[model samples]
Target: MTVLSVDDIRSRVDADFDRILDVLSKKIALASISAHGITGEHMKRSAEFVAAELAKVGIDAQVVQSHNPDGTPGAWEVIGSHIVDPNAPTVLLYAHHDVQPVPDKAAWDTDPFVATTIGDRLYGRGSADDGGGIAIHCGALHALGDALSVNIKVFIEGEEEMGSASFIPFIESHRDDFDSDVIIVADSGNWSAQIPSLTTSLRGNTGVDVTVRSLTHPVHSGQYGGPILDSNTLAAMLISSLYDENGDLAVPGIAADEPVGGLQQDVDEAGVRADAGVVDGYELAGTGSLAARLWTKPSLTVIGFDAHPVDGSFNVISPETRFRLSLRTAPSQRPEEAQAALADFLRARAPFGAEVEVEPTDNGMGWAMDPNAEATRDALEAMREAFGVEPINQGQGGSIPFIPELQRIFPSAQVLVTGPEDPKANAHSPNESISLYGLKHNIITEALLLAKLGK
Candidate 1:
């Protein structure tokens, strides 16, 4: 089988780019928000759309179902396979189709479901997150056409944004279906728009819900404020205890891993401030370089809290307060151990004899892959050839729970992570967008890597 020249592949992709964006627009319109009980018609439609797209590329695809943790229906997982040759190496392409909810529609410049192009940026929810990933895969396959050389398996996950509630069970029931020689996860981001990057490590994660109870019912603040402790105030203190004056994680068990030596992205202070909407004169928290704080060390986040409405003026001390805590562990740390330590800390720090309970929510272990693996080296070369720049070696601070499972199941398979997310992509945030330049280059790199591995 002869490989298509890079120019030919690029021509194919450029010609079909509009169709690729059309498919992505249709998917974005589905509103497949897994966490918001969107496992019904919308989810089904999204999966079917992907299946049809894969079919266009001569891949046999279907929608596979799994149950949510609460026994409710879960999003449909789209699985597609193309066997070019029995002897050639098989590659599994992984990305999610589900998207995060649009919390505030007013924040978006255009309708969240409508893909709007402003110059080279395409803006919409899921436009950059995984929708871009879905588009890249479809575009690459379409561009390769008859020249694609490897046995291919495309897994467009349905519940990744919901922390993959159905991941383990879905994998358990279809273990044999996912077998492959190489796995390419297109769920991460590039180091910058021009420079491609490969994620070498991912942080582990765990979450806990803590509730503080000070009284059975609310008490009048004017009458009881002097002696009575407010549950909300106590909860604040408990949260504050998790971080010291310097903003480092004060948790006992969570630990950082030794940094991977390579070409790491230097933090752009202005970029960080703008992205975070940080106020003037605010100092960056924690110790060490920004990369170390983000990718190598544990970070704590207060996700949500149960509190009174600020609009409703209440002169009462609250009876109960609840907040969710998420801890991102180092790549080498165990999420369960860190969760246990957090529980212990919360339990011991109950203020003013208030009743405190910490319930663990979820735990996902971290993953690290060999950057020097033969498949990885081939991928790097392909990327360099396609983009005309050396790929950046980076580590992701986010957690992809099922990656470690894939490693364990396919012990010999190489895993390569790549995607089109740049700093300005704003995935999972308002005004999400994808760089057109990055998207094209990523598709080319993936196509080239597939050709390289196929031979």
Candidate 2:
């Protein structure tokens, strides 16, 4: 088999992307939102869809599932493989088929499930997060055709949006199938639409639920509002204490710092504001380089609150209130420690001595990858050659607990996290999209890497 140049691979991928776009669009149309207590039918269909696509590239594929720790069945996952030579290195291409729920339908300018191409972006849910990733794997395999050298396997997860609780079980059940020499996790984002990035770090996370009680039972606000504060008001006070005057997370024992030597870089402030959709006259929270604040900071957010509903409410001093806090820890900190510190912080700072009870709801470890590995250099070189620009070593602010577990399970395999998501990708939010040029570059780079590995 003849090895192809990066330019040759780029030209082939650029020419072949029209078909790949159709593939991604169709996948995006299926609202495969994996969550707790939902029917797994959509997940099953999504897994089947991925399997069928893998089969089109000469990969023998199947839809598989496993049991969670509590014995509940897990969401469907698509696993497939195409073996050209048993002696060559095996590369596992990873992506997820699940997407976050569309919280508000009216907020969207276009249908979230319909892949509408506006300008150069393919607008739809899951288009950038993992659908583009799926396309990259499929498109690269399609572009390479019969010139394959390394064996390829695809792991399309179905429960990533819901925290992949069953990933360990699935891998334990199918250890041999998952064992590979290299793993490319394509669920991360690039530095920008025009710049490629290798995700080198991810912040760990945990959730804590704090319940504050002001009274034993409800009371009329008009009659009892003078001296006593409502539980909801008390909850607000507790939440406010999590941040400092500079808007940095004020939690103790968790501190934000700069990304290590090779990954240090600053992001455009205006671009970040626009991507985050900050309303007029709002400034970003936190201090220091934008990348450091985002990639390595500890962030505290009041994700869910149990208070009086605004719709049909009567004037009343609520007796009790509950809120869930999502704590994103620093990249190098242990989540268990973060969880402990958060619980302690809440317990100690009960505003006005409101009876507060804190419980640790969930936790997942963070991860940092080595920048000096041979496979890392190879992937970076492949990106530079394909995109004709220096690639950035970046870090993601999101958490993929399954990633650390994957490394623990396959300690010898080099994990390379790269993807098509950019700041403007708007992943997990309305108006989500992927840049066409970025998508094309990734497909070409992966094809080049596979070709190099195949040799």
Candidate 3:
């Protein structure tokens, strides 16, 4: 079988870039933010729209409903398969349609739901995170069409932003339906604008909420100022013990190791501090390599705290205080085991005579890919051909929560994590945007990958 000309396919991809972005922008405007991720009606709609578009291009597309054990709305997985020969190896292209909620609309420069283009970037919620990635995949498939010889299977789930609670089960039950020898997860970003990268590992995550209780009610600060067991004080102490002076996690069980992967370009610490609104003298926790601290080691972050403020404070032994802790574990760490270890650490370290309760929430395993696999090599060649640059390998500090499950289901499959977004894309932050230049390159890259793998 002859492969499609790279220049021809790339030209087609470049021509469709604007139209693809328009489709993605319209989808983002529909408010498919999962409502606490309980129901997936909005996600289903987005999946249906993508399926319809693929069908218009003569691709056989369908929505594979993977329900929860209790028959609730689990995850809507969109499958677009085009297989000329059943004996050919299938390639699964993965992305997620669901996005996090835009609760802080006031912080955004433009309407969070509206896709606004400022200069060369498209700004909106989910515009760069996974939406743009999905757009690139669909656009590539549209451009390639019958030129692709290998079976192309596209799977876009609706529950990735969540913990992907139903993903593993669905894959386990219907393994044959989603079986593939190579999988492309277009959900990560490059290390920098010009430096292309493939995510080689993802840190697992576990969340815990701790509550400290002292007295039954608030007492007068003036009367009980001395020897009062303030819940706030206890909570602060507990949270502080989570990290040492050197900024390494003090918790046990979670493993830390020097990064085995290549490091990304160093970010300016001062700039990061300024953007984060940290005090002048404040420094980020930990030492050694910043990328090592983030991608290969465990980190404990106090995400939120609930306590009385000065305005309303009676300053008594404040009845109770609550705080949430997010723990990022190394790729080799088990999330459930790490969660237990963290819970035990908190329980043993709590102050005496204070009622402390620790509750674990949203624990998900991390993922690590075999970087030397044939599929990854092909992907690198494809990226190089499209972008004129060899891709770098890096580990993402964030957790995808489903990649490990996918790995388990397809033990022999090769997983490739590459996408169009850059580090400065502001994903999950205000003014989230995607670069048109990156998008075009990624569309060509995806198309080239299909042709290369088919050959």
Candidate 4:
């Protein structure tokens, strides 16, 4: 058995860091951002690029196609596998190639499409969120080269950012192609720099639009002052009822429990607030643990309210108003059930004699990792060897819908979430960046993991 030392992994990671950065920078420049995600052309191109790289590394690669019921190409996947031993446990590495839309260029320090390096940090739209993740995996594989002793597979999806509508079906259709003993999803981040972390849970999400219609047109406020119902007033009342005075969600049938982990540090809190531009006097919910509130408890947010604003104020009662509600449920909760419960709650809580309609827009389940698995143990050991630190187990607040679906399909596989980004990475926000030191260490950790698993 060849045990990889930290120095050995570090040397290999340092040697390939520049090349890995170059690859990621070029890939981000390709503008694979889908349009409402109906087209797969960009996805296909991204997968092809990944496949080409694998070919250069002497690994046989292929594009696996999954089509919709209408026979349209729904997803394009790149599969690169090196089967060193037929009976060895196969590991599947996953990352998404698609990026979110870059809406405001003025808010960004650098062009969102151009991957720029400034003072040891790379800035771009998807750099830390996922581009860096893909690069890490590729770099690790390149470092492993001929020393690999186990079968390895790389699977990249383009629909993850868009709800992964095609992912579950594709996995079911091509079940045999993705057989693996472990799944490494390199899309999440650590608690902070120098602190390696493993994400064990993710919050599920359900969205709904609530519309209130009380009259045909805006009526004069003076005339309607007597008893006429106002949609705006009703909308406000309904929205206000979503939460209790304690800042906890008040929706019926949804569960809220304390998170398993503790709250983030003051530094982490400051970083998150700065990145998000949160206003003063506003604070995150839950008393004891930040991670618990984020990952374990339920949260309801009004994404958008469609009532007329003060700019276009009129002396009349608005006829209709609509608001978008986004509910983040706990990892153990079912999103569909939550959505149904929300709908029922809204129907029952609507103001008397007011017409209320609740409609579900999207729903996705949360993911939980099985800790007692061989692959997880190997990964933890590998991370410890590379970072000289024990990885902290925690949970993420966001939703990665495809993760739960993948777990369902591969029940016996170990799911590991460790990536290069830290708390200050600013993923999905302006001035997004990745720490050079963190990226290098993550690359080393990944290489160590590959070497360990291969052995």
Candidate 5:
């Protein structure tokens, strides 16, 4: 096959922009949200849609099925492959088809299930997280056409938003099919919409549900609110113990890694305040820049609480209260170790002899890449040429459990994490969207990287 010039690939991607948006629109129209106690039928249909898209670009694709741990139905994983030569290195392209639930319908400017374009951004649920990822893979492959230099395999996951709990088992069962010399995960975000970024590190995570029981039944608060330790008060104390007076993560075993080669994140204080919707007298937590605290440090948040409903709140002291704790662990820390420490700390510090039960829900390890590898260098150059800007190396605070798992499966492979999500993309939140410029540039970037590595 003749080598396509970088400009040629860029032009090809540009020429196919309309078709790309159409593909993205079709994907966004499906409500493929994956969560506990919900059917993944939409995700299965999404897998089929992706497989059909891959087929249009001369790739043979199939939807593979797996089951949840409890024999519940699972999303269908799509696998597509096109080999140029047997001796050439294979590049595995990874993305997910599932997305997070749309929490509030009233918060969106348009229908969350429909792709609506405003200015340069395309708004919709799953538009940026992995749906954009799917478009990138297909667009790059379509542009390459038959002139492709490297063997390519696509693995679009079906349950990423739900922690990818069944992903390892799926990989083990199809280990031979995933053999490759390099893996490119296209589910991460860029540093900014205009600037290209290569994610170099990801924080690990663990979540637990804690329930505090203080009484056999609810009683009138006026009578027992003082002497009896209600579950609400006890749960509040248990939650407060996880933080220090200065508002840092007070867990014993977790600590931040030294900054990545003294590299600081590009975010600023004003941006953080504005993006977080901070109120007038609110001060930031932790020392160092917001980037340091976000990308390299551990943090804790009370994701959800199961106390008395606000509408039906009576003058009663509830007997039991449940809350879910999400703990983001340092990249250098093992999530299981941190989780155990948290459980031990909570159990030992039960306030007023309250019965505390801390049950771990999920644990995923963190990952760091060797930035000096040859493939890494080639990718930086390819992205610079494709995006017309010097690519920044960034770290993500979110955990992708599949990254660490892929590292374990293919220890020698070069792993590149690149995607189209920008700062305002708001992935996993209301009104998630992707910049059209970011999408076009990332597709070109991936195509160029494949061209350079394929030979």
Candidate 6:
């Protein structure tokens, strides 16, 4: 089997870049929102679109539906296999076609479904999140062509943006189809537009629903204002207990002092603030480097709260308030332990014995890639060669729950995480996008790695 030279790979990718973006644009127009209230017809169309695109590039692809938690049908998942040789290393390319819903259309500068290019970015709903991921696999395959010697399997999910509810069940059902030597998950972000990086670790996550009960029924605030407080205020106090003076997580049993898997580089404070869109006149939180606070230490956020809306007249004090707490555990910590500790803490600090109850919600384990693995070395070399700069090692504060499941099912397969989303991608937001430069380089890097694995 022949391998594509680096120069040849770059030339091929450059020539077909437009075609790649064209496919991405079509996908972005699909609006395959996998959340509740969305029709499954669009998901089917998205999966078929992905399959057709992969098939156009010479891969034998098909769409399959996985079973949801209740044994009901779930979203469509695309699986394409191109077997170059039985003996060569088989690589599984993972991405998703589902996108987040556009909540505020007025906030977007351009149509959320239209692929609008401005400056260095191509903006749309799923442009960077996973649409670019699918584009990467397709572009690499197209560029490599006959020179791609390794067996290739493109696995594009349809429910990634919706918490991947059927991930475990789907994988278990199709375990044999997903077996591979190397798995590349192109669903994370690069360090920046000019610097490429691989995500080495991701924080684990769990949620606790804390309910504070003050009265059996609603009471007029005018009548109860002097003597008793509302459950909403009590819930606020319980939430405040999770943070300290410096705004760091004050949980006792969770949040280890240090990041378990250290990175070769750390993020700049200014860069973090800028990327996160932090407001002015605000100080950074926690007592460690920005990387530690983001990637390793436990963080708490009030994700969902049930209360009376201010739009309506709400003079009555609601009897009970329930709010969902999303707790991000360190990369090395178990979510089960974190959930237990958080529940205990909330139950203990009930704000003057307001009859508090904490119930655990959805949870996922953290992940740390083997930095010294052979695949890791190959990826670094590929990034260096493609980007003409040393790659940065970074950790993600968010959790990809299914990644651990993939590793668990394919324990012998080495996983490599790469993507086209830069800090400015703003994925899941109004003006989400992908850097055109990063997309090209990531395609090249994957092509180079594939060539290397084929050897």
Overall lDDT per candidate, in order of appearance: 0.86, 0.85, 0.80, 0.78, 0.86, 0.88
Worst 10 residues of 2 by lDDT: 255-264
Q: How do all models score by TM-score?
A: 0.88, 0.89, 0.89, 0.91, 0.89, 0.92
Name model 2 segments beyond 4 Å from true. 35-42, 101-114, 214-230, 255-257, 260-263, 309-319
TM-score (C-alpha) between model 1 and the true structure: 0.88
Q: How close is candidate 6 to the true structure, as a TM-score?
A: 0.92
Least accurate stretch of 10 residues (summed lDDT) in model 4?
258-267
Candidate 1 lDDT score relative to the true structure: 0.86
Which run of 10 residues does model 1 get worst, by summed lDDT? 258-267
Q: Report the C-alpha lDDT of model 3 over 1-455, residue by residue, as the tens digit.
A: 54678889887887887789888898788667755553656777877887886776656889877777676767777777777788887898888877778778899999978999888788888888788878888888877877877887777877777667778777778777679988899999876666577788899999899998878878887788667768888888888888888978877787886564555455457656765688877668898777677687888888999876779755456779999999898888898999999899888887766888999998878888776688878887887888888776678788887788788877888888887678668877887888877888888888888888876
After the best TM-score superposition of candidate 4, give how far the Cα of residue 135 lies from its true spot, in angstroms. 1.2
Give each model's clash number: 0, 2, 0, 2, 0, 0
Q: For residues 127-147, what per-residue lDDT tens digits would candidate 1 score against the true structure?
A: 988999998888888888888
In the predicted model 3, the residue pairs found to clash are: none
Model 6 spans with C-alpha error above 4 angstroms: 36-39, 215-230, 257-261, 307-319
Residue-level error in angstroms, candidate 4, position 106 = 3.7
Please report how far candidate 5 places residue 234 from its true position, in Å: 3.9
Q: Which whole-number lDDT from 0 to 100 does residue 273 have in model 4?
A: 77
User: What residue runs in model 5 are displaced by over 4 Å at the alpha carbon?
Assistant: 34-42, 70-72, 102-106, 211-231, 306-322, 350-357
Residue-level error in angstroms, candidate 5, position 383: 1.7
Clashing pairs in 4: 259-292, 263-290
